[model samples]
Target chain A: MSNGIRVAALEDIPEGEGIVIDKSVTGTADDIALLRDTDGSVWALDDTCTHEDASLAEGWVEDGYVECPLHASRFCLKSGEVQNLPATRSTCPHRVEVRDGEVYLFPNETP
Target chain B: MDADISRVVVVGGGIAGVSTVAALRAGGFDGDLTLVDTGEFPYDRPPLSKEYLAGRRDLKQIALRTPQWYDQQDVRLVNLTAVTALRPAEGAVELAGGRLLPADRVVLATGGGAARPPIPGSDGERVHVLREAEDADRLRTVLVPGARLLVVGAGLIGAEVASTAVDLGCEVVLADPVNPPLAAAVGIDLAAWLHGQHAARGIAVVPAGVESFEPTAAGIAARFSSGHEPRVFDAAVLGVGMVPQTALAVAAGLETERGIVVDTCQVTSNPAVLAVGDSARTRRDGLLLPRTEHWEAAQQDAARAAATLLGRPAPPATAPWFWTDRHGRHVEAVGRMAEADQVVIRGSFDDPAFSVFGLRAGLVVAAAAVDDPTAVRAARRMIDRRVRIDPARLEDPSVNLRALLR
Candidate 1:
């Protein structure tokens, strides 16, 4: 059931930004935040910030982490571990593969 | 100095103290670590005035760390106990039961108590103060529907409680001497806009301080400093300020002015005893800087204290930032906006989300945002890195903040 679904082209996510894929597409509990780090690596985390009601998709991606746009709480893109205060819980990170400039998401599967 | 370290005792279980232990472990400090706290568990305080006060969250929900954390970290958790003395000479801390825990380093995170201004009848049963979870529990009981609540001081805590109380169906009247509160922190223009939000959301905002309080059969009568007619309310909340719990430090002979005087490394006057959080104040060049009383400040202090304990280089310093949720608005401010020569509004006030950037010497010095945390976060980097940017580009919402950093 955890098939790698093509979500978006790699270029769709700009460096240092994120895009939210609706939970409907991923069949996950929450929408997924597709992040493109400044270093050009792609990562996926649950869209909602663990500390509050906020979209991680709207966060700033830099230095391999996504900062929650609500309170500046940051999460490691690779591990989804919180790197900031006011947020102690980590978001769920999913496996993603980039092939031929296209992003394939393995929903509910950790990378 | 680092070679001799073995045992470390952290007093208090608030964010500051808890994070101290957290940072110490994160920094690879495997020595004997003991945390003495009066509470059963370390919990976050910001929620005390908002979510906890509204009965939306519980004690466990606000706990800073899981119960297994202390055990996993191999740090001794002495819960429901107070540290009565800091015996630097004996190299230990005296707990309430008279047990002295050995310590090579002692960290004081005693936090503070909500200040109850010197107003007659201010200590009445109806008067409330939000600091500890117990205080929130007491205040929440009276926040029933149609309860007349008088929230004094329109600062962060006061404003937050007023917002929470109002949301709980209490008729809130927020009184403060300042016309628009938090002007120094968020700037006058933004302060006015923020304070105006109270009225827009059905809270009564008064530009006056409390002269006195008189408890009567009907309720408590509060006379405003503005000399207006005295008003009666079912309950009163004193949010004027906080009184640092410095008695312990003072009794221990730690140099304390307004707060425990600590150096840049979070070391107190006594090298063996260090302090952090609200109860600790930083002194540099024989000058004591203001005590940072926010949650993030406490955490930052803990990290710094941990670094000192581990004898490691300090983490990269960043611009200070804090957030407050009031009246359903998530507001955040970073840096010293009062020092800014100019304030630039990034978006229209009428917009759903906007930010005000304070600029000085062609650089962003501070920023406050309404429903716009990204702007504040970006502004924080600009302030910390001292990035020069065009005001026009900053003012334009279309300009990506990341580009401004370049």
Candidate 2:
């Protein structure tokens, strides 16, 4: 099961935005976020804000950055660099691949 | 003197001040450190509002560091001295006794004094604000069994005081302008839960603003803004709020907004000066976080500022955390959440051990746990890692949060 990637359909997420996929892994409690960018590109990152523990999913997505809802700190969707104060560290970004028109997100490993 | 080698003078002998000193020492700073306090001793402040009020702990137990620790750390302690004037550019501070101490660096740790609301005829022997040891001692005497106690403001401090009073078998009436206690900090729903807890424990909570107060034959009469009725009690404890001690910082030509304006590194407007604790307002994303007042934040801010001064990369902001104790139950909250978000409850709220997770935009933002330390600790990791969890899974008490990280 670990070797074969689980494919999530592209239609699962709306165009130009992201949605959290509710998939229960063997050891994880929460699901992962699958993002569909403006360019029809897919990127995956942690959905929670590193600072103050706000939700990144609720944050505003613009200019390839996600703005934290609570404090307005922005994090790059691609590189996950925190582009503002308050949140100094970058968020965890997962590897994404699209196979057979299906989106697959690898669990984030980099801290 | 070299620009890098600066003497920082921190005012206030409380937790914020000493914590800053400890941070500086831990940062490998060999610079001269001077800590001034009006009180003759250095002690923790939180207990002054709770355990100390209940006579469970004394001043010695609350002291953060002993005299020997100060000497070993090479920190100069100036007790019973009040800072009268701050001349920033001049690099000097004038004490009330007319002594001028020079400092290349200055830290305003002079936290704040408890605010006393204007209640006519409420002064004399029965009114007090528990900000100092003396205030707690005076209130302790009035906590005898069957003593009538009226506590104003249902804030964290006031609620704790009322809980202590109730535990001592005192007839306690908690009056507040808000509908329920802790509404300002947590929210109406959480506050209602807290209100129920207090009510079940026999505390009479009055959700009405005060109009006037007068000394009556029955002790004291309190008129409400509603004008519907008047209530009387034996004594009144005010827990309105704290007014930050920014006068010294302002006098020193430091920029002051709601608090002493500081950068991300905790550096004040004056480069040679830094502010921490309740007095410093840290600006992030154009908004000033005017001190979380959680003990951990103070220490972290001090450490970050000291490290920045020593030419190290600024440390990341500490995860916001705070805990409150009431009736043998520990309530802990982590992360920031808005009232508009969806709240998921894990386990039964009626149960002593339960946790509430706040979700927004399909992501977890904040969490509150009551006597659920394992859940609280797990939530802290998610908060630190910014992990998004399934709202349903988080609400399921059967799911262990620690396993979610893997």
Candidate 3:
């Protein structure tokens, strides 16, 4: 059995923006960001930046990369690869699938 | 392309050192990495002056990386081992423990040490200079509520400590030789405004140089050059400044000015050695930025230096950036304002959020935003591209700085 959970609705998150979904899967304060790219593609990643303890939900998303609001470190929303300095570690990329206009997240393995 | 670049030695286990090691691993550099430090562990330094002093944060939370993370990253941690000298000719460092670690490449991230004033009795138990984690831990126990805290120097650290003391309900007195804080970095007008802001917060801003401090039964008494006005205080904090640890670089025959002189790639005079963080004095377009002590600058410099070591072209230097938090208010600034000819103010001064733009030769060279992250973000981009916006538009609070970049 897969340990996946329904996080948010597609309508709740607009296109070309990110919405932070708070969940209790992780003992720590875990926040997941649902981002919609310019090409209408959606991606999910951990809201806490791996470099510093900054919130990625406050970051600016553009061209499939979410720039950390604190230091402007860019991270690829899909692969979670940190594209810039200051933040060299990649954020935990969550597996997301749209089922009946609702987004379900698999919180176990981070890509 | 890998031409035998294996061993990488990082000196100094502060934020810059740990970040360098992490960045190298993340950048796909599978080298024999060794991190040497005099300190027991890698910890955050910024909090030493603020949260740590206020007894709000514990030592465990400030550790940059857990011991397990170092092992997982394949990093060799040499703790409590001080590097006495650097032999750049042989690409090796001499540790005080009588060990020589040879490396294909070396990174000097030794950071900076606190600068103590020449005044007598400056090193007493009642007086303290904050730099390391232990320093803050020891100082926090003494900075009790209702204590008379006399803080010398009005720089970023000085001001932050003063603000923290005030928040803790301590009687804080701020003294500096200069009339206004940051007058040397920022202009007099801005510094004066900052002084006024601090004064409004009920802190006594004493504009006098310290002659000496005498220990009394109640506390320490600070004597200033302007007629000795003795004030008993439970504790005193010295946040004067920092001196770059460039002794190793100088001993290794590296070019030294105010700090270890480095190029855009953060490469010291010796091509095999690089300096990053506060210890590096990088030159850009003939201007020497001796002390870009901000955390962001250290991270960027470390990344650039790493790229240079890997034989990659480094990115162009962006505008200088720095931020400070005082009395729950966040102040962020970008670029060098010392060279600006025109100053533009946006938003009402009475409002909590406002900004000042510094323009030189019609270009937005620098900006300082108070409680205004939006304006700061815009100013960062404008400074990065060296873009010139209309002075009137810059002064208008409604004008989005981001649109100006567009």
Candidate 4:
């Protein structure tokens, strides 16, 4: 009955790290990557890298971008714009908000 | 001679060639640029042995650039055309059917073909080599479940094919002279683990070189150099190495040893011509460096070649990096492991993620990881930035890699 699924507490995600919201829970076609940048800002994007089947949730988050773990393709966490290749297509950005101390995920919605 | 160049022709459509064109356009080179390729479209080759062979990705999905990219970049797409000759004296490129195209400069990005060793009876119809998309397609048809397969050379390509074949339910026999290959590139420990994984996953690992092949009524029989009895296989694949495609350069009277010799700027012996990718080998200070046949190496060559042609400072060199994926495990290595005097591993080999760091004189020289690309990425930065690090901290799994950068 809720559009925003309360996934975790704000403290659940480490700074400059990402956690995956499985596809079944998010009700999306793919898993979602909830990234916490070094600046303490939270962002969400489809976890599956557009270039391949690699999970972006496992990528290295730094400087407002997430570098794919399999390949070094960096994606802008804010806009999901690909900053490099072997990945040319941008991942899908998602909307996220913090309510009280909980993080809410809006599936298939842009921030 | 202030770079009044206008028309340019690039031969080959591999990663090196595409990257060259992309880099040229990115660097504001508005000259008349043309890409002459032998394929219908430029596609990435790494997937040929993995995804494409597994029938997971098709030709279009593996394309390096889209159809709209050529038009957007204003690059003339001369598909299915091969440059027959490089007439540097007249600044012209001759194509098949005797058409001469005027060019101010020529970039030779022709990639290499798979090495076909002189093994007796190797030319049989059952013998195969994977290089082009067509080759992958042909290999795929025989990869049916339970088909007996003999893959020679336990290197990257051979191991990858063996892993893929096993996944497809094919009976895979992997043979190589070396007990565990890739030691110099990824260090000894990781190499052993990677090589040993084949046997644990339903693959027959043989420590012997192939002697010859004999076609029998039942598939093909292969004799081993170890004096083992002849084994029958439905098919066999050669994954030894690559032979540089330097015929055009040789016939054109350019300097070629193992590959086309180029200077710091990727300019070939002929000033009017340049070579990049596997077909190009760099000669610096009268020293010829070995040809790097990896995907990233080719891409890196593109950036350097563009800068050289545009008269801009070449991008600062970084630690060389490469990657391979097999058995659902992703492996990455940076720099040269052979340069290390000490090797320290982060986390256990059985862990989901582990990295081996190669250190020399308290400096991180190289690193290889199993499903831990972050560690390799951090290692690459440490190597490039020349950051001094303590091996103890690097080995501690609890220490975040970012702290090591300091």
Candidate 5:
């Protein structure tokens, strides 16, 4: 859907944590990974690892980088840029907007 | 002299050489820079053993950087050229064509060549070594399904080629002088498991030596020192090790021991010249450190070389780390695993996810993991920081590794 879909409330995702919103709108099963920064900012990206089929939601998030658990490739949550190897390409970034203490995930326009 | 450098010449266009050029530019060195490489482009080498040998990754995919990156960085990439001589006194490098280029500073990143041990019939047409792309291409041609292959030296390259060949439907026999090869690097227990993994994947692991090779009517027959019968194979590959390219440095009168000698800053005896990568023998605190051949070590060496050339502070040294992928599993090891007094293991090795941490006096000295990088990463941090850890807590899988960071 072009319109924003409410995924979770601010309290659902703690500071410096991530959650996988498995909505089918992104053309895959629960592919959107919503990350809440320590600064209380929410960002979204495709959950699938660019290097492998691992989930980014299970990865460790620190210093604005989401490191894949499988191969330890770190991806910048904000820009979806691959910061380390075993992965050469950036993952797809999803559009996210937060308002009224709720996180909304819009369909990735670039996808 | 204010260390005022204008033109910098880097020999060898491998990862170390490319990283040196890139690091120089990224570190804001806009001076005249030239990268002389023997190849058409700087390409990654690890894939040459596995993916490239398996024909899974192409040259374009494995290239370290696009051709445009050199042009954008204004780095004069002199491809298909080799430095014949190093005139360090005059700060000049002589290319193969007898062209002399003046350089305020020189970085030697000439990497290494595959060591071809002298064995009877080792020079045969069917025998090969996987060092360059051309070598991998040639091996790929003979690695068809139903092909029989004998790979010598069960180290990383040999094991990788054996795995790839097995996946390609080739009958593989990997032989080394010692059982469970790479014990010194991966520790004895893990090396045994790794050797077992190869055997489990339909590849034969032999603890013996190839006494000689003879070309038979059907294929190449290899005589083993283990008293086994002469085995025939379609082809053979050598993954023994690397011989550092240090002849040019030696001829140039640079102090060399094992490799081109360099101090902690990666500067040769002559400050105007520097060396990095497999060819650089580093000395720290008046002790000559062993030259590392891993890809990440090369990158780190290049960074230090660039910093030394730029007169900038070298980055804090981190514990040595390396990784290898085999049979669809990723293994990473950090620090010195060989010298640990005790090995604390987390997770069951029988199960797929496990990490073995080498402890010395309650501190993590080294660690190796199979499919579990979280432990390796934490172990690296603990080792680097010299953090005292409770081995009991380390052995307990229930204790979170990150919690130890605090």
Candidate 6:
């Protein structure tokens, strides 16, 4: 189920920043976390950390990796690969595009 | 004297030893690497007290890395073997099977063993010490529903085991010499709140010393120093911390006081020998830093030791940090909490989500948070960047913490 929907305005999230789109806005079953790296490249991933119930949106983003604030585990936002530990699994990555100054997120169907 | 540094041998198979080997390989070291560990596999120890002990996780799940990973890394893992002696002068380590392995450098991350105080019925079959996987497995058998468990000591281990036991539907009595343990680390007020959280979860907090344990008709009787009636328990877990394994270091004629003394580079007095983890104390210029047993400390030690061997500058020193999971709440504390001159409470303690940040001058020194990783994350950066913070703003949750960074 591709819930491809507009999540937030492009300017809403500054460069090298991230924003969390809760289920309320996305109309999806999961929270989508969108991050914009320093290069102005945007990526989308599951908001919940694979290790625990903490929100990946609450984590610190740096160099394309988002570090879970709970246990310091990090995940690559682009590929969803686990870059650090306490977290053995990777969060599901989603397809994203910025068009007409708006960010659109296509949630991972299998996530 | 570099002494033709080519081959390196690391003793002990815990995180420190394994991480050192991994770091060495990651740093593009193409030399012979050997690792000697007493355990069958180098598993993660933190899970032993929580998920693994609760039977929610298995040994394979806790293994730091797969066997194939070691092979890929070209690390010779000598499992189920002990380093009988260390001959630092000769750059060799004698194994339990009377084999001497030559090396240019040797790292002793022997770890430590659970401290078993002299208790009357400690020899009993039901008395358990949660250190190794075997200890957790034995304790798992008796942690059945409605079973009575006496956990001696209220430190991290005891409190964690007690939390796990409660989750297993066991009647847990956490006894300690002092009420609300870890006051020195988390402050007295917060410690009491944590103790109360355990009590609220139906864990009996016995703020008294366990005088002795005697075998009774039904189970083991734990007599307390508080003059209370002896309480019988189906099993007792000793969580009185660990004793550093330093016999081999002493036997090797290395200078040791409590643990193997090493410098900031993790190099022992004998240049060819190094020590890390729970069995190592950092010493420099006749002064010593207290040895730490936390998991992250071991990892940092391994990184520094590896950098030393690689002839590279040491990584930037970050504040020490540790976390604990108890009563379904994740509590994280970073840096030295005791060094704070002022304390700021962010969020109300009555609320489930709250944090306390300790500050020295205007900079954040340390922070302890319950279910609030955002605050702790900000606090860690503030401490690392040495960013000055306004105490009033810290207490006000409306003020963005990251903004204070700039």
Q: Indicate which candidate wins on DockQ.
A: 1
Candidates 3 and 4 compared by TM-score, better number: 4
TM-score of 2: 0.75
Per-residue lDDT for A1-111 in model 4, tens only? 355998889999987778999889999888899998878788999999998988888888888999998888899998999876688788899889898889998887778
* DockQ, computed on Cα atoms, for candidate 3: 0.18
lDDT of 4 by residue, B91-180 (tens): 999999899999888999999999999999999999999999999999999999999999999999999999899989999999998978
- On DockQ, the stronger of 2 and 3 is 3
For candidate 2, lDDT tens digit of each residue in B1-406? 2356568888887767887788778778888989998987788777777778888878876676767878988999999899998877788788997998998777778877887667776575667788889899999998999999989887778888988999888999888867765554454566678777878888887878777778888688878776547888788888888777899887777889878889888888888888888777889888876567666567667777777667788777645766777766767777775532888888887776887777667666677777664565566667677788888788887875655654
Model 4 residue pairs with clashes: none
DockQ scores for all predicted structures: 0.69, 0.02, 0.18, 0.55, 0.36, 0.47
Ranking of all candidate structures by their TM-score, best first: 1, 4, 6, 5, 3, 2
How would you encode candidate 1's per-residue C-alpha lDDT over B239-287 as one tens digit per residue?
9899999988999888999999999999998999889999999998988
Q: Is the docking of candidate 1 incorrect, acceptable, medium or high quality?
A: medium
User: Model 4 chain B, poorest ten-residue lDDT window?
Assistant: B1-10
Give residue A53's error in model 5 in angstroms.
Answer: 6.0
Q: What share of the true interface contacts does each candidate keep?
A: 0.60, 0.00, 0.00, 0.40, 0.20, 0.47
Candidate maximizing TM-score: 1
Question: Which regions in candidate 4 have their CA more than 4 angstroms from the true location?
Answer: A1-11, A23-28, A38-40, A95-111
lDDT per residue for candidate 6 within B1-406, as digits (tens), equals 1338789999998889888998888877888999998889898898888989999989988888778878999999999999999887777999998999998899999999999888777878878998899999999999999999999998999999999999999999999978778876777777888888988999988888888888888899989987877899999999998999999989888889989999999998789899989999988777888888898889889989999998988888888888889889888778788898899999988896888999988789999888887788778889999988889999998887766765
Encode model 5's per-residue lDDT on B1-406: one tens digit a residue.
1357989999998889888998898888989999999898888888898777788889878787778878998999999988999887787999998999999899999899999999999999999998899999999999999999999998888888888898899999999878878777768998889889988998887788999999999999999996977899999999999999999888888999988999988999888789999999998888998889988788889999888877799988888888777788878889998889998878887997898999887788999889887788888889999999999999899987867766
TM-score of each: 0.98, 0.75, 0.85, 0.94, 0.92, 0.92
> Between the candidate structures 5 and 6, which one is better when assessed by DockQ?
6
Positional deviation of residue B237's Cα in model 3 after best superposition, in angstroms: 1.0
Give residue B261's error in model 5 in angstroms. Answer: 1.0
DockQ (C-alpha) of model 2? 0.02
CA RMSD of each candidate after superposition:
1.3, 12.1, 4.0, 2.3, 2.8, 2.9
